[model samples]
Target: GAGVSQSPSNKVTEKGKDVELRCDPISGHTALYWYRQSLGQGLEFLIYFQGNSAPDKSGLPSDRFSAERTGGSVSTLTIQRTQQEDSAVYLCASSREGGAHYEQYFGPGTRLTVT
Candidate 1:
């Protein structure tokens, strides 16, 4: 994809289940980040990967959440044992090699709704 891509724009899952959302970044972007935006909330950083390495993952809410980058261009976020409170818009963004200060282009996110 020319821009960021995310799958299952809407996901309805039961609590205690697992879900995997995918992301495809731009051609040359080496930095990818995941964030969650709860309803009526702002984007909360979850994790970031530079190429195939995840240098920062301090923002994951619990052990149930994890993400990985593959080949520096694609990424996926997995939420295991989903909880009701985990419902939110999972946004994937990418930037050309730069700091968090850099503006990132975002995907249309996977909106997870745990019921």
Candidate 2:
């Protein structure tokens, strides 16, 4: 009955450092999505994974960003060589289905700060 859980809630890192943020989706949800939201910006879709099949890494901003989902329930977002521009709220959402699915619940997000 859990909604979604994200770790840290806030992260302060130095430039060029790497950070890993975690997300736990609701039980029995078959789809998971990762999105990045900057201040006053819209949600940017990073990647999505369903079951054990291939993942959609379409919106990954650069090679410095990557993510993986395990057991179709939990996911990790890794930002390599973090930059000041990379400092933003990393939000995670999940649904029981994808594409046509709406009302995807979101996590509290991990606010990454690069200083």
Candidate 2 stretches greater than 4 Å from native: none
Top lDDT prediction, candidate number:
2
Best by TM-score: 2
Which stretches in model 1 have alpha-carbon errors above 4 Å? Answer: none
| Residue pairs with backbone atoms closer than 3 Å in model 2 (clashes) | none
Candidate 1 residue lDDT tens string, 80-115: 999999999999999988586887999999999999
Q: For candidate 1, which ten residues in a row score worst on lDDT?
A: 48-57
TM-score of each: 0.94, 0.95
Local distance difference test values of all predictions, in order: 0.90, 0.91
